[model samples]
Target: MDHRPPTIKEIARQLNVSVSTVSRALSDHPRIGLQTRLRVQQLARELNYEPNTQAIFFKQKKTYVIGVVLPFIREEFFSQAISGMETAAMAHEYTILFGQSYDDTERERKVVAAMKKQRVDGLIISLAKETRRFDHLQALESTGTPVVYFDRVPPFAEAHKVYCNMYQGTAELVGWLYGRGYKRVALINGPEKMPASRERLNGYIEGVSRKKHKVDMQLVETTDFSRDSTYRAMEKLLSLKHPPVAIISFNDYVHMDAVQYAHRQGVAVNKDIVFVSYANLPITSYTAFPPIASIEQYPYGQGEKAMDLLIQVLNEKGLPDAGTRYYCEELAPTLVMH
Candidate 1:
């Protein structure tokens, strides 16, 4: 068995038809008779004929592969997201090439450049915290590849965005804390540039607005969204002029770190101070004293929706000239109490 890629010429020779007829029939051109199309398609499949991608791309002006960009694959959130994307891609008969930027702009630029040369059909991205310049993204889109921004999307990109209801989740957590009779509230947030920080903060502000509970801006500590930074920031916040009666962390990682900080200071959460964290990941539940409350975001569902919408665009051969917007799917987060 010759394992080399089969060509249209071989199929045409075996079927006793001109190469032009074979090509048109194999592509299922409507003008070609159904019987002719079926015969050519059957032979093409039997020969496992995969047209030369470069030439076929020149003809169809599209590639079937998609590029996926994520901030950190090590995080369970992206792990679940990527898994959903892979499942959807398989159903659509499309391939996904992924890159992890580790939250570095320069590293992300390199990956984008390489994928550009690969001629990926489109892009699906969950932005990194350090991604500030939209120029690279614009350049890739200018090449006529559609882009779908998923969780942690660009702050200002008017593109198809699939994201969680962070605000509602945050508000829910904050309301739960107040109901628990925690007067003072503190925040250990992510890097100020990321969009999640703003939304989560907004929810906190809105939730605590009616109550006389004054928001101690001094108690709001920001870190690089890393475990060490979150822990250090929590330590500083706890050593404040007036420690919070209740503290809310950015997500599970922040919750875990803040809990560790409290442990070091001989404080027991839900006893001395109630704690609520967003993104109730599995690891958070396993901790000695998990977050008093958490936001159970749908990472898997988000990934699936992003890829499904992208498939609709891909199967259309190409998206419209003007960029499209797939509105954010509103998913109410689950409130998990530890």
Candidate 2:
């Protein structure tokens, strides 16, 4: 009446052989004779016997499972990135343990702790928006569990990371806008504490300088990425004596919010005020006012590369220089015109 799956011990008992003989025969060991191997295999198939992968993994000290933590799963960018991670993991006979931080540092810490408790082979993470301290991630590396970060990575240089180089793309966007005779440009950036915000600001400055335009702080605004905050930023820009003809947003989400606010004020999107942003997401196409152009950050490539890097780290764990090794990749963002 027992419903449990047949085990090696049961197989051995049925064949009147030792457990080692059954195990060796199932593995096609050379020491086991042909007849015994065939008999054990036939019985295994008939009884629906399956190898206990958990026991094998325990003996090997490897789970063949990786943890992936991102800020938000609903965001198309993160979803595409995870898809790339999944594809790469499958090619290596591994699988992902997925978690979402919802942009909260506390939630990210809890998810990471849970993954560690599960003893994942390694971890790939895109940091939460509010994560400033990396002690939690550092603890994992100290325990010999490799961690690779992608997209929203930490500011440190010692960590393994893969990310998009947005500076060049943002600069290119400025030059592109200038070419179209939109000399007065502005930017709607994210929280000042974020590294991404700094990258976009630097690029905006460089772009303006390249066109012989003086950097104007009055034209720039920072938003918390909330709808009300985006509306306030839009209002500030519109109140300028000479408003910018083109505005570069932090990302597609911010662009959507800013565009909606602009519409309420009768500002013609892509005409009276042209808008451009990053993360060339497909969802933007359906928005009432999509950006005239966007920077392709290649989230999928970032995710794949991050996973591949983590796998490499896991492979080289015991090597002499593995402890000192670090991998950092910065993919150049491309500006895509809509």
Candidate 3:
């Protein structure tokens, strides 16, 4: 009547052999005789004896599990990235432990702590919007846990990171706008503290200079990537003495918010004021007014590369000078026209 699963000790009892012998035979250890191994295998199949994977993983000091943390999975960009990471992890006989920080720094720390408690082999994360201190992340790395940052990475370069180069794409976006006769372009950028925001700002300047147009700080606005914040930014831009002919948002989500605000103000989306953004998310295509062009950051590729880099780091953990090495990969983004 007992429903307990058969164990190696039980098998050893039935075969009148030592537990070690049963374990060795079950594993087909080279030291075990073929006849004994065959007997153990046959009994295991008949008795439905299953190896304890947790015990084996504990003894080997590897869970074969990777932790992934992102700001928001609801955003298609992060969803795509996680899909790529899952694909890469599966190829290596590993699984992913996923968490979302929800753009809160405190929540990010808690999620990281939970992952650490789970004893993950490695971690891939996109920094939260409010994350400023790297103490928690540094603590993880210091404890010999491999950590890889992707997309919204930290400001430092000493750590492993995989990200898209938005600066060049944003610059290209500006040039594209200029070519289409939208000379006076404005940028609705994210918080200035973000590296992504800085890249877009620099790109906007470079693109303006390339077109021989003077940089206009007045035309640029910063937002917290909120609906109300974007609406306020749109108000400020539209109130300018000389409003921009085109507007570039931090990303597709921001682009949608800006476009919606413009529409409410009786402004033609693609006519009176054009919009462009980054991420090139699929949802934008179905929107009533999508960006004329978008920066394709390839979130999925970044996620795959981040996971691959983490696996490499995990593989080289014990090698000489491996601790001192850091891997950084930057992918150049492309401009996709809607």
Candidate 4:
């Protein structure tokens, strides 16, 4: 009735009914008999009365786009996961936007807010290393945006995900190291705030501290995922009064960092240090000297699975609010020693 681009008023005049009745019937108010509501709806449809999306927002606002928030996609592992999401999105004909939180809590919050303002219908997220709280993630889900977490999700946070069976890889890697006669092994760990860090550390501890060959707790050095941090941590460990003859690094990325650190310290990688990196990315093989071995967790495959899971979630009318949906794969590892 505001004389804008035609609305219910014109429809009501054509149907010979009060504007209030048209509005109520259009809304399918239960108090108004079903037959009356049906007739009004039928007429509205016939007239092609396009309900103003703004009006709908005024009532129940929703946007159909999706946002994918990642800590950093610089790693090939993340690249694969993103591919999976893109493949699934293409199939569904849905558009996706990306946000890199860069491990800063404030930056992460800003990205989340931006996605909320854009009214994304869903989210696919991998928390930053610094994220210790799930309140922001939970709030978005509460608003009806389906969120599927992947990779480095919080330990206590319940959500859907696709990840690697780190324990399996660790057991295999550590068992091999012990077999190679590297008993006094050391672990250069990643940032404690990261899920992968804890998972990897747990696997290392459980694997080495078994029926045989127990690792020394003092040999473990905590560091960030960056090459510089890894190098620094490795330096501290190597400077130990009795340095470990073998080092099991966090991942291939960190493995490269550790390798470089050893090189700088006038030590040969395989010959002197006997290094092994978790998550054997192709980049690892191309290192100046390939690590003793690396667990080949196919990020490309993981990414594909992530997309598949997201599609399933989007297909479902309503996903369960409680419980978690997780898929973890333990793929074969390749030990390519130089």
Candidate 5:
């Protein structure tokens, strides 16, 4: 009449063997004979016995869980990154706990605090657009919990990071535009507070300077990476005394706003505007008015590499030596032209 799951002790009693023998057999310990281990495993399977993860975690002082914090998962890049993380975590018998901040700094703080409360072994994070401070992340690291930041990483140098080379990507895109005879290029950038945004802006400036083109401050527009903000920015850019012959968007999602506005205004994209941006989703290729080209950031690869580095950090015992250099892996972005 009992509905409780069978325990190792019950399995031992049923097999008429010592508890240690049953435990060793279940674990496939080399000390246990093959025949006996097989018998114990078969019987354990028959009983639908599941190992107690809580007990195992307690014994080893490990949760075997990694927490992932992101701005949001609706974006294709973050979702693909999570897929990569899941693959790597599964291979090592670890699980992932996910949290989305929705680009809200307060919400991000709460999500990170909750993850800490859960006693996660490690953390992978992409900072929120509004997160200007690193106190929350620094507090976690001070507790000896390893953190790996990707995509929208902070200015912190001590923590591990995995990110795309946005500076190079932006520079190459701008140079290509100029080479194609597009002289006046406008940049619809994300918030200036973000390091990636600053890198892209710097690249834009450098590219223009390299081409001996005049840098027009009016051509640069900053936004919060919102649909409404991007649409408004595009409107302002087009209404300029001399609008740009080409435009570089902050990212593909923000570009969608510009595309929609262009459609409503009967403006022919790629031909009329010559848009370019960073995109990893397949949909970017199929869009009726796709950008002239996109920079492939390889979100999945970033996630995989981040997880690998985090696991390695977790395995190393003892505190890191003071002023020790940590790991930073920067992946190159490839240009995919339509």
Candidate 6:
């Protein structure tokens, strides 16, 4: 028994009409008579006819699908962003395929290659921490497939990028700490290679200068944004000859690790040492002793805007104007003081 799904040809043969007529009728072509269209539709329902989407997409020269690449999806921040993207894609009658790289550059490269091979119309990416080279991304662009980068984007790429203004946010937080009479301020930043880390470091320097405070090289420590790294950084900072009265961590997760270390060392958080960091997740508020402040990057809003821009670029014919060849959207982050 060679059982298969019913096709348009079978419907046409049964109705004694041409295959072209059946297709036009099913598509509701204006040239097709209403009587014939209704009859074809009725017969299609009776036969449980299903159109071949692949064939349709091939003829239209569009997949109507987008690929998304992220460092990891387990984080609440990334999950919220994915929700925003899915909402937008649903409204546009499109589907998405996701790939996670787990913060590995080699894995990210391979995932991107797979998406390209799948012939996705466009790509959205939040670069992995280990990603330093842009050759793989550049290769995708050469194929005329548009890519929109969100948080943790490559600094040198000329593609459409959307990210939070971490520099300004960090500067404001630092100044706020100074205003509260915290003289000795310490910073625990992420990898120096990351744009976010570099920007935040510059912001810290600017804030110190703006407050007319002396810059203390001993107070600043760079980490890999890991729990162990942040804990060690916190330990080192507390052991300094003149420990800082306030600390700014890389993000909420890293800040939590530092707080735990402070608790173990008998240092009262938000009392002995004022703490601040980026990523104002809901968990921050539920903590027994939360940080003094945090920066809300609005990950969902970033994702929505990034996806909209990508869709806009996909619809545009030919190359964009010279002045608008590359687009960058920077979303403002709010300083949420607890």
Q: Cα RMSD (Å) per model?
A: 2.9, 1.4, 1.2, 6.7, 2.0, 1.8
Candidate 4: residue 145 lDDT (0-100)? 70
Model 6 worst lDDT window (10 residues): 315-324
Clashes of 6: 0
Q: After superposition, how far is residue 104 of candidate 3 from its true place, in Å?
A: 0.7
Q: Estimate each model's TM-score.
A: 0.87, 0.96, 0.97, 0.76, 0.93, 0.95
Residue-level lDDT of model 5, residues 105-153, one tens digit each, is 9999999999999999999999999899888988998887888998888
> Candidate 1 lDDT, tens digit per residue, 1-338?
77778899999899898899888997778988999889999999988888787787778777778899898899998999999999999988788999998888888888888889988888888887877777887898777777788888777746677888787777777777778777678888888878888888887777777565666678778989777898788778788877888888887777777888788889977788878887778877678878777788888888988999887766664346445544455567888886
Residue-wise lDDT of candidate 2 within 51-147, one digit each (tens)?
Answer: 9999999998999999999988999999999999999899899999999999899999999999999999999999887789999999998998999
The whole-model lDDT of each prediction reads 0.81, 0.92, 0.93, 0.75, 0.89, 0.88
Best by TM-score: 3
Per-residue CA lDDT of model 6 for 72-113, tens digit only, reads 898878888988888888888888999998989999999999
- By how many angstroms RMSD does model 6 differ from the true structure? 1.8
Which candidate, 1 or 3, has the higher lDDT? Answer: 3
Any residue pairs clashing in model 5, and if so which? Answer: none
lDDT of 3 by residue, 1-338 (tens): 99999999999999998999998998789999999999989999999999999999999999999999999999999999999999999999999999999999999999999999999988999999878899998899889899999999888878999998888888899999999899999999999998888888998999999999999999999999899999999999999999999999999899999999999999988999989889999999899998888889999999999999999999999999998999999999988887
For all candidates, the clash counts are 0, 0, 0, 0, 0, 0
> Which of 1 and 2 is the better model by lDDT?
2
Which number leads on lDDT? 3
Q: How far does residue 91 in candidate 1 sit from its true spot (Å)?
A: 2.0
- Least accurate 10 contiguous residues by lDDT in model 3: 164-173
lDDT value, residue 335 of candidate 3: 86
Q: Write the per-residue lDDT of candidate 4 for residues 1-338, one digit (tens) a residue.
A: 56456588887887788888888898878777888788889877876778776666557544445698887778787777788778777777666788999877779889998998888777878888888888888898777676777766667635776677676677667778888788778888878778888877888888787737656788889877877788789888888898988888887777877888888889977887788876667776566877767777766666566666766676663558433454343344455444
Q: How many angstroms is residue 151 displaced in model 4 relative to the true structure, after the best TM-score fit?
A: 0.9
| Candidate 5: C-alpha RMSD after superposition | 2.0
Candidate 2 C-alpha error for residue 2, in Å? 2.6
Candidate 1 collision pairs = none
At residue 171, give the lDDT of candidate 1: 74
Error of 2 at 247 (Å): 0.7
